[model samples]
Target: MNIVVIDYGSGNLRSAAKAFAHAADEAGMAAEVLVSADPARILAADRLVLPGQGAFADCRAGLDGADGLAEALTEAVTTRGTPFFGICVGMQLLATSGFEHRVTPGLDWIGGRVEALAPSDPALKIPHMGWNALDFEPGRHPVLAGVEPGAHVYFVHSYAMTVDDPAHLLATADYGGRVTAIVGRDNLIGTQFHPEKSQAVGQRLIAGFLRWRP
Candidate 1:
């Protein structure tokens, strides 16, 4: 199998690539993990991973900046229904729009808006950094396969998603209130937390993605 991690000049492409490579090995799947910006390779991918960090508008600009890269991704994931994974700001990009520095349009794959996280506690931080437990339905999604609810996953972000529909929400994490951790439907899956940075729980998630048929 071929897994393509999009290089939009945003995320830690090498780290993500390494994580997937290791996951594939453990899963007993002979898969090739590629970190690339080439649109041609993207279109030919069996699975797609979009990882982003930094500002929403800036990441979007980087993806759009690459010739035919954005369009190729849309076709591969949105049209072809190839199993798609989005990490951090990459997950935020799946929304209809995000208001980080300015109002920016997203891929709109999940129909949501990325907004600043509002923790109920006054002392809580904005960036919601560090490890947090997940709250999810048992046996609800393929990506959460062996990962139990309350499992610790790494997170570091200021903004979170408010999905248009509850059916698309896979899991959430509590900081002071509900923070969307994982969101997906059909062939798409995303995490606000960095699975690469999230140790064992993260590895399980990566392995789940590798074995995921849809």
Candidate 2:
């Protein structure tokens, strides 16, 4: 299987690539990991992983600036039903639009909007960095097969997603309030946390993603 990690110059792609490779190995799936921005490669991919950091608008710009990359992603995931995984800002891109610096449009895979996190508690910092426990129903989604509820996942972001439909929310993390931690609808899934940085739990999630047929 060809696992293409969409690379539109968003942060370091190597770690995410390595994690996916290791996950594929652990899952016993024969997969070729490629970090690229080529639309042809995207069309040929068995699965797609999008990783991003920094501002939501900037990430959107990077993806849009790429020649046919955005269109290719839309076709592969929306039209062809390719399994997709988005991380961090990549996950935010799944929203309808983001209000980071300005109202920037997103991939709209999930009907929602991305906005800054305003923790009700005064103690919680802006960037909810480090690890947090995931509140999810076990075995509800294939990509979260072996992951138990309350598994700690690493997160480093200030913006959070608001899903229009509650059904799309697979999991959440309490940061002064309930923050969208995991979301999915059909063949698409995303994580606001950095699974690559979540250690054992993260690897398990990634491996599950590799084995996921959806």
Candidate 3:
């Protein structure tokens, strides 16, 4: 399988690439993972991973700035049905729009909006950093195959995706209230947290993603 990790100038590309590589090795899959901004390479990928580490609008701009890269991604994932994995701000981009700094349009693959986390409690931090437990939905999708409920995962974001459709939400975490942890619809999946930095749990998720057919 040819896995492409998009380098849109706003992601921890090296860590993500290394994590995916380790997962591919552990899964014993014949996979070639590449970190590239080239549109042709992205279009040729069997599976696509988009990682982002900044503001929603900034990430969107970075993606759109790449000549034909956004269009290629849309064609490959939406038209060609290539499996897609979006992390952090990459996941936020899956929303219809975001409300950070302004109302910015997103990829709209998922019916949702990215909004700032309004914790019920005043003491909770803005960036919901550190580790938290996952509450997987019953009969979760294949991308979370071996992942268990209550499994700890690392997170580092202030805003979260508020999905319009409840079924699209695969897992959630508690941060003064419920926060979207994982989401999926058909061939696309996303995580609000940094799975690459989530240690063993992250590795298992990565491995599951590599073996996932849909």
TM-score of each: 0.98, 0.98, 0.98
Ordered from best to worst lDDT, the candidate numbers read 2, 3, 1
Which has the greatest lDDT? 2
Candidate 1: global Cα-lDDT? 0.93
The TM-score measured for candidate 1 stands at: 0.98
Q: Which ten residues in a row have the lowest lDDT in candidate 3?
A: 137-146
For candidate 2, the 10 contiguous residues with the lowest summed lDDT are 137-146
Tens digits of per-residue lDDT for model 3, 41-119:
9889988999999899999999999888999999999999999999999999999999999999999999999999999
lDDT of 1 at 162: 90
For model 3, the superposed segments whose C-alpha errors exceed 4 Å read none
lDDT by residue (1-214, candidate 2, tens digit) is 8999999989958899999999888878899999999999999999999999999999999999999999999999999999999999999999999999899999888999999999999999989998899998877788888899998999999999999999999999999999999999988999999999999999999998888887
Give the C-alpha lDDT of model 2. 0.94
* Candidate 1 lDDT over residue span 1-214, tens digit each: 9999999999688899999999899889999999999999999999899998999999999999999999999988878888999999999999999999799999999999998888999899888999999999899898789799999999999999999999999999988988899999889999999999999899999999888898
List candidate 1 segments past 4 Å from native: none
